[model samples]
Target chain A: MSMINYASREINCKLVYYGPGLGGKTTNLEHIYGKVSPNTRGKMISLATETERTLFFDFLPVDLGTIRGFKTRFHLYTVPGQVYYNASRKLILKGVDGIVFVADSQIERMEANVESMQNLYDNMSEYGYDLTRIPFAIQYNKRDLPNAAPVKDLQASLNPGWPVEDAGQQKVVPDPAHPGENLVDRVSNEWIGHAPYLEAVAVRGDGVFDTLKLVSKMVLKTLS
Target chain B: MAGAASWSFSENDFKQIQQHLLAFLRDSNARCALLVDRTGQLVATVGDAPQFDSAAFASLTAADFSANDQLAKMIGEHEFASLVHQGQKESMFLADVAKRVILVVLFDQRTTLGLVKLKGKGAVESLTKIFEEMFNRVGAGPGGQAGPGGTPQKGLLEGAEDEIDKLFG
Candidate 1:
């Protein structure tokens, strides 16, 4: 249930950053907030503990141009990653329109990522929301870090349903001469169907826009 | 104590009461306590109920109470003093505090109704001072600004205009 504010003519959408603890969800948002035009963004408020852990949530409202004469404002929030804060997380999800599940790309965080995704699915079930119908994107972040899982391994383990092209299928293409360099072809070469997956070093701003563009498109599509 | 009686009705006095409420609820065996404005916006909360959706709950509860108030009016009563909702497992007690705010208590069935009402009396008396002070602050002509939306960051009431339509005729 998204709210459309008629005064500002801005359709306000709530997009939550959800993932396991220490998955860089906050870091990803901080990067985006810093990079976007200051006039289009508001103060980023973090209610973190004295130890630098998010105690409640972080709220950052961003304006993403206009859509059909309505200023599109997205209120970005991040849930406290600690498992004990599940109750507070549930409260934050009350009117969420989209989600960015920041999955740590390191090999060790695989289990944590799966567990957190399951928790999200369960919480949405409580509110009678079908997870597949909601606008959501996955970011395999920290890709620049050492010990990061290979993209192929991550696809197989975390996103088994991911649509990526197999090497055998690539041979049938016979395009080794010039190589399929189009964006759509590249995405299809990496996935099974047409789902777009972004790899990012979020702190350095790499692939950040790609993720943002995908999420913004998905959200607007859902609204219509 | 020169202005003690007038002070009793001021928001400054209400601050003292709000501080006391925190200490009072902790000792009362109640898990959480909230002071909700007549509009159902939470003025304060105590204990570890941050997980509770205070904003949404307050808005919905205010709607419920507003409907109840209308029902009371149909029965020829001017207003409702309090509402106590008890289910099999959990119970909520809402009481009016100085006609401006509602004091809400959430607890398990283990708590006694008599004890809760007695403590609520003391809490409400203290909270009345806070509400009076808030009224003065608000009535002092918007602290030099215009109405709510006049401030750059405050559109809290902008949302309320729509909310009012949902609550009352």
Candidate 2:
């Protein structure tokens, strides 16, 4: 849910960075945290363990200038990628306006990517949000690595195309338990599940800003 | 979890909330108060607050209160009414206002938790009334279409691209 506070003249939106473990999600945030000017950024809080792994999420609030007269405040969050942290992931996904699915391009991490993507879909299902429709983008990270999967194969497997069955997504009928049945019915079914892809090496800050810029624009467009 | 509620607050409401928080501070002998949303946004702040990163504090407080709520559920309780943090010099008392907002009171040895909680109740009453009116106004506003003042909400990304370019430059 995006909040437009007329009193403060600020527009607040939540964007989440989600992916498999060690897929450069946190590094993306860290890179942004380092680059953003202090006046435009806030404290980057990481509720991590002694080993510095994200326990819940990494939160960074950025004041992205003003739209009309209202200041645009984007709250960035990165969920813990470890599988057992599903509970924390669900808690973090609450009221998410957009998502950046960071896919590690390494061949060895392909299974983990799919598993995490399914986890994202499943967890989002619980909150009555379908990722396919939401303002989402994809980042093929670790592209500089030697054993990276081709973007074509990644798209064939992950992207929901016109003719093929959307893996694990065919069963996404309207949830009966959800409260807004009529509203859901009224919403357009033209949600493109797969989003524009960006090649990134988050550690080096390559393609990081592009990912943020695209996701930010997509989320803001949804608000419009 | 905040479910699809876009907030629309008027300037008058902010003034009233600030007044209530000031009164709460004087009565409770606390140093500062902050109204934080569950998503870790610092809705408002008042009083002789400590010199710290308020954004960081807001995020951590929301996270702490959330973790505490889950812990309470594990114990089979609905929720903890207040979270008290004790330090050698400063003690912070945080209370829930309508379950959607948090009221945090920062104090030192000059005050006690009992006094803060006692005064916090009256503050909560006033703040709750203010928030109730605010939320009602939001409810009356058509889903993210117009604000309480009947002004059409502006598009979120209008001119944002230029701003991003400026920031990067």
Candidate 3:
């Protein structure tokens, strides 16, 4: 949910980073917190276990400068990626303005990625949130790993387009990041739309900002 | 879009909210009070709040309140209306306001929990009424509308792309 504080002349939006355990969700947050100018960021808080796995969530509030005189602040959050933490994940998703699903790109974590993705859908459904309608993106993290699965394979498993039922929205929508690729197109006589995605090696900070920038733009577009 | 509940507070809305909060602080004799959205955005603050990161504090307070709500369901309760965290020197009380925001009051040895609770109940009632009126006036529902007038300002997103580029540039 976005909070428009007219008195303070600021707009605040919440963006959540979600994925399976150890899929670099927290790492994405840590990278952003470390990179953004301190003056534009707040204290980063990580509710993690003793071993450093996210226990509940990690939060970072970043001031993304001003747009039309309203200071835009985005609160970045990462849900605990472990399976048992589904409850915590659901709680963190309340009133989310945008979402980044950071999928582990390695071959071995495929099942975890699929399960977590399904969990995301189910949880969003419970809140009556249409995953496709929101400002959503996917980050194929750990791309630098030797055993990283092919992008096509990951796309097939995770980024398959959902049916675009509305005729008004069924037109071809190109993915600006990947020329010659359509984010929304007719498939097997059915219009389908996929969330825009980018590959990332989060630990090395590669593609982190690109992913954030993509989703942030989508969110701003919604607000505009 | 579902779950897109944006809340807009005009100058008049804040003035009224702050008045109530100030009165609550005076009556409760609490150190400070923070009106935070359930989504973790600090709506308003009154009194002598301790030096802390207000943004982080709002986020954590929302998380804490949310986690407690889940805990309530486990025991078959619909929800826990309010929560109190008592520290040795300083304690805080959090109450739900119209199910839209959290009313948090911070106090210390000078005030007793009994007094804070008594005053907090009245504060919550007043805050809840204010939020209800505001939500109704703005026509805000699950599908959020823009500010009080239901129109977004021009150029809100026109130069946003350039601003984002500068963030990393």
TM of chain B, each: 0.68, 0.82, 0.84
Per-residue lDDT of candidate 1, residues A42-153 (tens digit): 7677768998788767777677776545666676778888888786666566556777778888989888888888898788777676555567777888999898999767
Per-model CA lDDT versus the true structure:
0.63, 0.77, 0.89
Sorted on DockQ, best first, the list reads: 3, 2, 1
Superposed by TM-score, candidate 2 places the C-alpha of residue A187 at a distance from the truth, in angstroms, of 21
- Candidate 2 lDDT over residue span B1-169, tens digit each: 3124455565676788888999888998889999888777778889986599887788788878888888899999999988999999988888888777899989998888889889998998888887876676653442434533343333334445565445434
Least lDDT summed over 10 consecutive residues: which range in candidate 3 chain A?
A: A215-224
Lowest summed-lDDT stretch of 10 residues in model 1 chain A? A174-183
- The best candidate by TM-score is 3
Q: For candidate 2, what is the lDDT?
A: 0.77
Q: Over the full model, what C-alpha lDDT does candidate 3 score relative to the true structure?
A: 0.89
Give the runs in model 1 whose Cα sits over 4 Å from its true position. Answer: A162-195, B1-169
True contacts preserved, each candidate?
0.00, 0.35, 0.71
Model 3 chain B TM at 0.84
Which stretch of 10 consecutive residues in model 1 chain B shows the poorest summed lDDT?
Answer: B1-10
TM-score of each: 0.52, 0.84, 0.94
